[model samples]
Target: MAMAAARVVVEAEHLLPPGGLAPDAVQTPGPFVDRIVGLGPLGEEYAVVRR
Candidate 1:
């Protein structure tokens, strides 16, 4: 009962917008990729791994 109510509340709140957590994350792969790419961290990985 408690879990179901919590889920309903979460779903209701998740109807907000793009920056909202659950709604935004529903489709995409989350912001880990964006944060790493934005910070240029992948360059180090590529340089270290490439021959």
Candidate 2:
């Protein structure tokens, strides 16, 4: 559920036109990161190995 929502937000950001806002106008509140750890049958194994 959360992943779906986050993906939507990321996709929407990609739709925004270039230079719509000043580069320094926005800042993340804190450290933030997103990543796709794995997919399909070997996903669990890949995630564990990545950790």
Candidate 3:
């Protein structure tokens, strides 16, 4: 997350959402996919139903 934020700050002076990064800035993908996989079926099965 800090990498994402640094990418934004390098390009813009003001506060920006994590999505505001340039394509090149996001060189490596975040741990999002790995985390989702770790969460497994129970995670997906209940994520929406409970939320």
Badly placed stretches (over 4 Å) of model 1 are 1-14, 22-51
lDDT scores in order = 0.37, 0.39, 0.43
The order by descending TM-score is 3, 2, 1
C-alpha lDDT of residue 10 in model 2: 23
Best by lDDT: 3
Model 3 lDDT per residue over 1-51, tens place = 645453422222244466776768654465422321222234555666541
Query: Across residues 1-51, which tens digit of lDDT does each residue of candidate 1 receive?
Result: 433342221212223445656564554343322221212234654776542
**In model 1, where is the ten-residue run with the lowest total lDDT?**
32-41
Give the root-mean-square deviation of each candidate in angstroms: 12.7, 12.6, 12.8
**Candidate 3 ranges with C-alpha deviation above 4 Å:** 1-16, 31-51
Clashing pairs in 3: none
Q: Mind giving the per-residue lDDT tens digits that candidate 2 earns over 1-51?
A: 443445422212233355675768535311232532333354655666541
lDDT assessment of candidate 1: 0.37
